[model samples]
Target chain A: MLPHLQLGAEIEVGPGDDAAVVRLPSPRLVVTTDTLVEGHDFLGHATTARWIGRKAAVQNLADVAAMGAAPLALVVAISAPADTPAAVFEELTIGLTARAEADGASIVGGDLGRAGQLTITVTAMGSLPLDQEPVRRSGALPGDVVAIGAPRLGRSAAGLALVLGERALVRAGEDGRPTIMLRSIQDSSAADLLRWHDAPDPDLSLGWTVGRSARAMMDLSDGLVRDGRRLAAASHVTLDLDRAALAPDVEQLTGLAAELGADPWSWVLHGGEEHAMLACFAPGAVPDGFRPVGQVLAPTAHGPEVLLDGAPIEGAGFDHFG
Target chain B: MLPHLQLGAEIEVGPGDDAAVVRLPSPRLVVTTDTLVEGHDFLGHATTARWIGRKAAVQNLADVAAMGAAPLALVVAISAPADTPAAVFEELTIGLTARAEADGASIVGGDLGRAGQLTITVTAMGSLPLDQEPVRRSGALPGDVVAIGAPRLGRSAAGLALVLGERALVRAGEDGRPTIMLRSIQDSSAADLLRWHDAPDPDLSLGWTVGRSARAMMDLSDGLVRDGRRLAAASHVTLDLDRAALAPDVEQLTGLAAELGADPWSWVLHGGEEHAMLACFAPGAVPDGFRPVGQVLAPTAHGPEVLLDGAPIEGAGFDHFG
Candidate 1:
């Protein structure tokens, strides 16, 4: 199990005993924990263990990245049934180690337990450079320009929609579990969208690069409108999204939207799990990896809000309880 | 939810945005993660959320303590059904904050998700003093003496056995879930044992005290023989247990073991979930909180082993998969 997990040079005592000891270069540490549960966050019966593990690690790494820090290590806790094959856990470890290694990090320690449904919880630890303050969400100014690391959105939500729609055509496997069968989707791009939903490849370095000049930073996990509203509220400002500026993203999903009888605008505004970096920069300070998608304005008497094309947008994104 | 979670002064940015930014007084960080799953790690229907939360936090804190580090912060991830009452989560958070605060630590951040079973995954971060190295399990010398932080053992395992034996007499609640009913036990001490099983009270400061003079240290989560073998294997030494030294522990459980028709000696040797510190110190360097129970010896041709009175002993402890 220790061999399955990756250890970095910074690790003083790798996993074997009670805990892992690591030397962090800086005094400031960024910590975040996230979980992916079977049947809610993902279809455990349909999704591969590797992708599930990768998604769990990437989501937490995205949080550390959003803090504008370099990922140092990850500690994972996984729960599965006793009957689960050993291969599944090994594949999961491979996925977690590979994703952590992608950002020059390591899976230093973890705990494995028994549960009814397979569940994974990953906590990522990151290091901030000496004397550098984390780019917090509360630093956006009235005139700050709102930006996104990439101009792509809604692929994950669309992929989820496709899966749900095809559930009726699912084939039962030998284990009596429903196996994935996308009978209605024929395009490779659509399949790619499904893959994106299963395993999102977030740009881990973009936040650190943009943090150098950005006033505020965050990860777009719950959708632009939802997470953007949080940034605006934290900074005491209103974000006015430029619909025209997001035309490219909507266009990218228009074909799939039409086929699925869904609105591309809705997907662009409220889709979740993109894991892209959402940030606010000073006027003319947008970084290379990001594109301006909106502007930060003074909060109105009504309070901080998220506006689309000068009008208030009303829609909810992914809510765990909902 | 943020109000429910405690934030210490060491936190620069608390839970709200992406992650929590915390400051450590030292460069060395000890990290560990552990999980508790319903119907597997615990009987959720019979346990209170607060006690469950306390047990979850204590187990991880014990790991950090075993490394001879000061508990700094905890990040928790919880998953439960969407229909769960908010009060349950609030209580859980309260228990977590209370336990961490007892050691001058805080619950800096956490995640909540939906799952079929209630599960909690806690990651604790601890800071080592400047210029001090963590007490690892592989540092034991042949002449070192093996000790237990406290003479208490098998209380948790005995408590669990009591609960399992009474499962057949469980009463159904309004929610149709089985509720706890311990009709067979009438003694108050027996009830206290059950409480101990639910919420372990690990001496958080004892490890640091003993670690100052310890050569090897680990948490006694599994039974003595199982975990002792681990320490011996890691240190490349054999541990010769003095059964006479453990007579007091067995005596403490003799009454309860008789009621359960079990051997008190077996409980002392092979019970799990103690959360007590196990360490090795120089022949005359046993700390006030620890009691010598064995002596380390050179590894023989058969390699490192755990022995009872110089004779090889064999037993098994808790295994998540098993």
Candidate 2:
């Protein structure tokens, strides 16, 4: 059923076997796994199987990118109801194939079984250059320049808000005040935001491109504010973000935010699943396609925290329990 | 919660990161994935979370061993109900850690999310010797000796029949004749059989030990009759078995089989999930732990078939769809 998988030369043996054998140029292998479940990660009725597959692949590829490794191969495991249509699996494989190929990786093998709800788990492997070490979250230091590749953020959270309607935006506020202001305005950017939420397109090359120079890095999956706090905590430093530096990203979404009656700042700070690369680099070492968003600083006795314009911001983002 | 996870020195980074980095001594990597879903792979009411995790890990480890690779590391992705007890996750992690360690591998990383049902997907990666090539299913040739490591098969199926009771055995028959005669038997082997069915213990070292000399190798997940057909078809050969060679395995279980009024031969030939290593070696190349049960011959016009004492046998084994 998975005809779209292209067997690369590095794959000594592909699917239809007990396991697949692959050749790696480097001895260090970067590995990660993630899963998407029906009714939790997606609404099976609203989202197509193909898009679900695409989103699943993007999540793993982004995780590898966050590790400063080049994507290599992925093995997918899928469990669905027995009554599910054959076309659904075909489309899902096609989606997975397209996304893996786009990220310069291939789908080498997978297992299929029956379950009550449809779930897809993808485990991705990656490689690093012979002499370079992985850029870890614990490597950021004081005076490091905090930057982001593909600076546009929060579009996914915006898209999810749109999909869930006005109540979703209204309920997202921590305080009693409305977090977003909704209005009807015709704009294609809203559609783009929705597409980003449905199937994110991450820049997979950004990790390997900055691997040699970046001090620390991660995928911006849980919003700028929440993930920024994690990066700071991991490195035992404080991240002081410049609000003006993020104003452009907010401005780009302002058109749709106004129509949805949403606060652009809320989306910029708390939106998630954007799948963009966030990294800390030495001064004067920021690579092309990355923009400075903040600076790393020594943590006070209060512990590592995210600061906006010299004021501490409370952590808030996608929490499955919350 | 995952306190039992003993991170080996090969793991550069463990859990709590976006992904993990591990060192592979060999350039060639063998990868496989498998998933267990509640209500299908296991009944949540009947199976403990720990045994489920153990079985899930064993399935993947055996797949890696089937490829003649040494198990190195595994990444697990779990999805469960948000209301699930915290202790359940702890026990599950302990189970995964135990099985992985027993097989000389480590749990390197994982992701957790909420889902309607508890589900786990494990992706295992293994390494091969620099000078050795992987043993593939299609490598068997005419005149190869068909052998199996730890030749005690069908214990898991017997255990399953015991757990499922008499009706399950009754429904397993193909021609309406009683395949098993159910009767109460006072034997600890019955409990041992149940344990094997629940959490199989596969010989992880057998693969790499015989990898260089074995012409073909695969894990016996399905029944011997079923997997043998696959091996025969893949290699364009017929597997002509000596029933006398398999009599000992059936004899071991004959005590319980006779007590239950079940035919020992049925379990030996059609029972699955033993996770034993099945390989084809040159007549004199069979390794120390392996015992010969059959021999390979050229396929006839009717195509590759499995034979018993010079007579062709119809294919019968575990079919998920069937």
Candidate 3:
């Protein structure tokens, strides 16, 4: 039997009903959804069900935050094989509830069914604060400062590389077990990187702050270059990111990059899954806790472009279908 | 490229952003989500992508109607194999958008991804009228009259049997083609039954009307016996049906049952996916357009039960994880 979900004060009628009724903070509701497929979104062996649940919740929570709205509630629909462990389901619920609760939201309702693969679909709802307008992706103007909510970038991608590399080594060895290889790379920084990749802690508070002041905003899930290009295209403006401003973020990844024989700058510019907020603010409107990395320019005949150090840089980021 | 979605007045901000901001009708929002998997929810070959899309939308739409709420918007998340034909996606979208539009709701936003099997998760939001409160499942009392939104039942289940039996015969043949078998069963009534199975058109208007006065209400996705039992348990009452009242509905299905060598009474009592509204009304409070089928009684030591013609009937309805 499933555990009883505590009904929050905002929930007039929670789970077990035809639909849940939740109090809305504003007259408008911000809604978004995301689906995570097994093998594609997470590796079963490399991650716990709890972490997978956490990741799934965070994906949508970050989207709500990117809208600059206060999180309200989440409804999830999960499908998995019938033979899946009950403990996995329990752990997943814990992860989902824990993450949503931390973000000031609750799992209001859900549906469970049998499927060939495990899939989690989360729909997040949020409300804007009184007198605040939602920051859109099409509001950027020429001369606006492009800033990032956090300096940490590419840590998740670097951590993924380390984990995948270790898995490959384990498969190549005589014994399939990865105990020896895992011990060989027991560095603290690598552990930190792996943790970041496993479960990202996005600064949702910064998203709220930016929503109040930024003209345009979005979350960086698909890396700087790719998502930056999206922001530029949406706002009909070109973004020119300064190399000097990104050097520190890239330098932080140099150690992991060297260990894996990769480029740190590539990780910083093109790695994804960081869930950092990227926004455009009027000159001098950029707030604290955000670092200026670029400037918006008028659109050209060739359309919007994202530049690095005055030159266009091709970005290789994850695409769900591509 | 995705087609441009027309923005309705209710949609403050549509797709292309982190989330959509939709104007709410009431201070409380009704939310629900449902997922349809490739193998479990439908057979890809047997059902067209468009019908599949419509079924997905209606499932959630009916849930909102059961709450007596006016549907506002829907957000969908779909996952399919990367190599799937683009036409399939287009047709599915056509189905989803068409159905949502028919219900006075728009497909405000969605996410797409690659997966081994095609999957769709829909989250629907609705608003209750200013004076009406949501009818819950636990509000029924003893002596309440049990009513049904429509007198027709079991047509969908009967149709499914005919289709599946035909599919089995087709696979047994040398050429593995079902055209001959399909043509052999070309009764207009049978076609209507199959059509109902393929795409159920539940009268959602009746749902809104019933929500205004029903003491307890739920959409019957599971068979009447099973879902009726659920309603009985939720309200701590036993539902005793008069066999004479259900005779007409069962007689309607007798012809299809004979063609398929099935039991009409069983289908009427145990068939599911009808999405008909089952409600309890205070004695003599049953609204127009709804047929009284049974009456509620106080719970006994045997617990909640659904009786047919003064005797308890066993129902083996479809269970997702059963």
Candidate 4:
């Protein structure tokens, strides 16, 4: 099925308005910003200025939406090298417009200046809609269901792999030669994954909806299990993840795994940029478009474990600190 | 005693809100953005990050504000090298907050990325409170009083003189002395004018108010006489600046001229960053706080001419192109 969740309702003023108007009744607004400079974040890979612009807006908007707040407005500042064409700049403007529209946010006004490299910065805003208190990471209870929005390892890491791997190697892997398997992976799929790596969608409303219902909510930006363990440690709650839900994402990898002689489940259970909403919901209740991948259980001998049926699974998804 | 103009009452939401809400009875919001990169624009010669942050917002906000719209919200994206401390970053945040508060604008949210140098980018939003119509440069009428809200030329450029005097010899005279003295050229009576360049205020509402009764209006940002010529050319009216009111600004400059053996009026007339509001008002009535610095008349011998008393002024103010 297509994305069950549609974006753009909560925005008081959508894209093209001078500025957006959104309400967060609790009297506090959380704000943050980020920028991407060309040749710095990504070099010669499957990338375009448009995707770069889209990613710039999506990543920050995701942060606000992940907080269970309704995203209201976005402002951007772009600095391009003088020789860069007006068209590339124009495309970026349109790219930002698309991402903002996807989540019902608008690009109000920003500044442009000459610089050494292509740089884009975005500021996103969201409103805390409910009278109920915001769901924070510290409140995960002992019997909470640790659920996720979408399957982990969808594109970010997969795309990274394609970018780093040799084209001949990918072809051999998909062709199913056991020792020469890395060669068989399809180059086109790799290309698509690379696009995802550069520009991925962050489910804007999933976290907000989960925050309204769940006891504790946090964004699973760092891989599934790595972030899961961090959440458990932060909340002092024990976490045990179910392995079956991840099977669909990794099933195609089984043959590829045999060629690489590794387990397919490792990528699925641990990969990052899932943009998945993770939360500790009360028993027997799950928010829309969210799948229960784990549970927040009592503190135990296992100690914040990720389990496949009955055994612990190891993972370290895109570590930022290390 | 207090701010001559009481604002923020029309500001539905202020700096701390999720996104500042503004009444935009107009259909479209005109928008633009710019990003300032260290080592490129301000080579350690301008104000600190706090003041840079303020100027960054003001420059863009002034654009729409000049167009006669209400300030709505701002999205700011800042990138600093990894070596930057928590204090500098926090100070920049505070500076942005203060400027937005002063303008009755609010910060929404944005991204923080790693870069080799400091990059500050901002996008601001404005809406025409007067439904459907935004005041543009094309609307000046003949015989309108060319009024202005005091000349600027205070600190932003003055600080530049102080900061970069070693490398950049100020605009000089035959004696080879720096001819343009800032202190002699602005209203020293107003500390607000002194604080202005670093934190210039946009006359957004006044633009709307002026535009309603105004034949045409524009923010005197680039410079006074330079922008005056534009209004004259656009409305097909010649502007004649009264040299008397200007004497208060630079009568002392004439002594500076005697010391340096230069024409002091040239610096006061041409020095830039005077964010005072200048507009063509109806011939008979003038707005409060606005002075009749010039009057609109039929084209003279020089096309769209700006005259100092009976003589044509020698030069236009700063031009980004020039």
Q: How high is the lDDT of residue A256 in model 2?
A: 78
- Per-model clash counts, in order, read 0, 10, 0, 34
Model 1 chain A weakest 10-residue run by lDDT: A167-176
* Models sorted by TM-score, best on top: 1, 3, 2, 4
Candidate 1 lDDT at A169 equals 30
lDDT string for model 2 (B215-304, tens) is 998888888888888889889899888899999888898888777778778888888888888899987899888899999999877899
User: A1-322 in candidate 3: lDDT tens per residue?
Assistant: 2343555799988889889988887768899999888878766656667777788888898888888887789999999998997777776777788788888898899988878889999999988755777888889999999999886788888767776676312221222222223435534477667667667877777887655689999988888989998999999999999898999888887776776788888878887888889999999999987899999998767789898866879766755423
Instruction: List TM-score per model, in order.
Output: 0.94, 0.92, 0.93, 0.68
Model 1 lDDT at residue A63: 92
- In model 4, what is chain B's TM-score? 0.74
Residue pairs of candidate 3 with colliding backbone atoms: none
Cα-based lDDT at residue B101, candidate 4:
70
Which prediction has more favorable TM-score, 2 or 3? 3
Candidate 1, residues B1-322, lDDT tens digits: the string is 3346657788988888799888998768899999998788777545677778888999999999999988898999999987888767877787788888887788889898889889999999987876788888899999999999875888887777776766313333444233455666654567667767777787878977656578999998888989998999999999999999999888888887788888888878888888899999999999888989999999978999889998977667655424
Candidate 2 regions exceeding 4 Å error are: A166-185, B166-187, B258-262, B320-322
Local accuracy of candidate 4 as per-residue lDDT tens digits, A205-299: 78666556877666656677777776777677777777676677777555544544545676566666555567788888887777787677776
lDDT for B278 in candidate 2 is 85
Ranking of candidates on lDDT, top first? 1, 2, 3, 4
Top candidate on lDDT is 1
